[model samples]
Target: MDNVKKRAAELLKSEAVKVVIGYTMGTNGKPRAAFIQNAEDVDSLIFNAQCVQNLAVYLSKAEIKQLGKPAIVAPLNVLRAIIQLASEMQIQENELIVLGVSPDGELIDFQNFSAIEKYLEDFNMEVDAKEKETLEKISSMSLEERWKFWNEELAECFKCYACRAACPMCYCHKCAVEQNKPQWIPVAAHRLGNLEWHIMRAMHLAGRCVNCDACHEACPKGINLNFLTKLMLNDAQEEFGYTGVTLKEGNLLSTFKTNDQENFIQ
Candidate 1:
């Protein structure tokens, strides 16, 4: 933690970055996002298991871009998000600095996104035991059983939109749910509305989602919306073998190939 503080201070003191986005002490001794602009403020910055929020979400924000250039203290998920963002043209190269955190709590001074991608080659997209068990339980269900199970979960959602807000990939200027002219989705939080909202959001994030669990973390009702997107991610990986962050021109879902499987053509 001290090392991170030192580096952050050095960068800010040298004006290498206009801001250093990382975790800091919040109320009740918790952790939250901290935008450190001054060298002295680096003391508040921290990194740990409790600092679970993916700070990469701010990279796409117009307000954050106004800060000149940012140095984001990124975890593994945030690293993946950065590469994915770069691939989607959401962010350009040399736009910001990345303060990457390794698994052993060491700071990796990634000079560029390509280096992060090479580092990511060794790390597997492994989920925790709890998440693995939950996915297994869901996968064991029959089609009708799965439908019934998910509906029960979705019924509790009151459309707070915390899930959408927390997602880094959901950086659209205007969301489909917010559109009223075509009425893409109903305004109310009814069963149909909730169903459509989540399904559409999952499809939109099919290959784009990095399984950061930001949606799950931000859910006021503890709804596991991350699971739905995770399923979509799994489907894309299993079918297309997409690595989520190819640093390519187009996204997996947006691009099509002649050799793609026609199983869904019907």
Candidate 2:
């Protein structure tokens, strides 16, 4: 905690970063996003197990960008989001500073995006045992059973879009759900509309989702939206040998492969 405060103060005092984004105690005594511009306020920065919110989502906000060269106190998931955002050209390496925190609570100050990428190479990208087991269970079900499961889960959705708002990867200026001219998706939160919305969301995030689970965490109805994205991610990996949060390649869906399987096409 002291290291975080000291580094934030130094960054602010030297004008290296105009703002420091981190976590602070909220009114309900939970860690919430904190933006500190003054060096004296660095003491408010806190990092611990309670600090679960991904501060990386603020990087592309116009108001935060207006603050000028902000520094973010990022966790592993946030760092992954940064790498994904960088690959997508949503953020530049020189535009922001990253104070990365590993899962063990160690603070690592990454000087550049390259350093972050290298450091994250040792980080495990595989799904945990519990989630993997759950995914396997879902996979074992028949197609009809799987369809029924998703329909029942999605029926609780009210089209709140809280999941979209919470996801760092969902940075589109105009979300498809909000479109009206062509009305690509129905606005009503009926069964078909809800199913369409979630399927679209999952497909959009297929090879891009970092498995942050922010969408699942943000769903008010406790819907397991993460499972949908995870299933898509698993298929992407099996079919294309692709994963999210990498700089060496373009998005899997965007790039075409000559040897790609077309067994389902016919």
Candidate 3:
């Protein structure tokens, strides 16, 4: 955390970018988004496993717009979200200054997306044993079992938008649920309404989700909302044969390719 903050402060001091977006200790000691306008503010920035919120969602905000070019300390998940956003025309490629951190706490001075492969090749360290165990458990579950598991878990949901608000990928200015003319989703709380909301949200994320798990953490019901994103991530790898892109803008996924496979469609 200190290393990242120090580097970010140096960037701010040099005027490499207008702002540095990172995380800070929140009211309850949890990590929350922190926007650093000057070098002095960088000392407050933090990074940890608990820094769960995806900072990517701030790139497209109206108030954040005036801040201009930004040097963003993005989680690997949020980096993928930025790449996906570039593909979707939500942001420009040149506007981002990204730095990556490895799962085992190594700073990757990646200049571009291709550097990720080089990093992986040089990364000979052992994977975190606990993360491997969690992945193994998640992999062992059958789809139906997983669905049933989440159904039981999400049953206590109170329809709070905490998950959406916390996510970096959910950046629509006028969410469909908020539309009064169409009212695509009802405002009242109900199982069906919640299910539809979840479905729509996940569909919107589809190839764009970066698997940050912020949605799950923000859910008051303890629902594993990110389970769907994991499923989507698997689908992206298996069906599209495309690993996710990096956070820098102007990669792929925004433009249509006629040669792309879609035979599964009816």
Candidate 4:
């Protein structure tokens, strides 16, 4: 924690970054996002197991970007989000600086996106064992059983959109749910509406999900929306040998290869 504060303070004092995005103690004694513009406020920065919120979501905020050359204290997940965002041209490498934190709680000051990519080479990108086991269990279920399970789980949704808000990759200017021109999706939180909303969310994040699990964590109804995206990610890897956290040009769904199998096509 001390090292993080020191580095943040140095960046602020030197005017290297107009703002340093980090974590601080909230009213509930949990870690929350903190924007430190002054060097003196750097002491409030804290990093621990509770500091799981991905600060990368703030990078696209108009107000935050106006702060001028922001610096983010990023975890591995946030770093992956950064890479994904960079590949999508949502953000630039020189626009924001990254202060990466390793799994062992070590602070790694990355000079650029290339540095981050090189550093992440040694990091493991596998899904958690427990999550994998749960996915396997669901995959083993019959089609009707899986449908019933998902319908039951999604019935609890109240259209709060907490998952969408917390997802770093969900940076759309206007979501399909909010569109009223044709009302592509129903606004009501009925079973069908909820199911459609989740399916749309999962499809949008298909090959781009960084496996941060922020959506799952942000769900107020404890809905396992991350599972949907994880399943898609697994399929993407198996079918195309593609991973989201890379400097790749085109996404899985956007670009097609001649070698791609079309066994499902009639």
TM-score leader:
4
By the lDDT metric, which is better: model 3 or model 4? 4
| Model 2: lDDT to the true structure | 0.86
lDDT assessment of candidate 4: 0.86
Per-candidate TM equals: 0.93, 0.94, 0.76, 0.95
Off by over 4 Å in 3: 1-3, 104-106, 112-151, 246-266
Over 1-266, each residue of candidate 1 has an lDDT whose tens digit, in order, gives 67777888999999989999999989988789999899998888877788778889999888888988999898898999899888888887688888888765688888777899888888766455687788889999999999998899999999988888778888998999899999999999999999999999899988898888989998989988888887776767677776656676478879877887757666
Off by over 4 Å in 2: none
Q: How far in Å is the alpha carbon of 177 misplaced in model 3? A: 1.3
Steric clashes per prediction: 0, 0, 2, 0
Ranking by TM-score: 4, 2, 1, 3
Clashing pairs in 3: 57-168, 87-254
Q: Cα deviation of 27 in candidate 2 (Å)?
A: 3.5
Query: Scored by CA lDDT, what does every candidate get?
Result: 0.85, 0.86, 0.70, 0.86
TM-score of 2: 0.94
- Put down candidate 4 lDDT per residue, 68-132, tens digits, no spaces: 88989998889988988888899998888898887666788887897887776677666667988
Instruction: Name the runs in model 1 displaced over 4 angstroms.
Output: 126-133, 262-266
What's the lDDT for residue 38 in model 2?
100
Tens digits of per-residue lDDT, candidate 3, 23-78, equal 78998878888888989888887778887778887888777768867878876766
TM-score of candidate 1 against the unseen true structure = 0.93
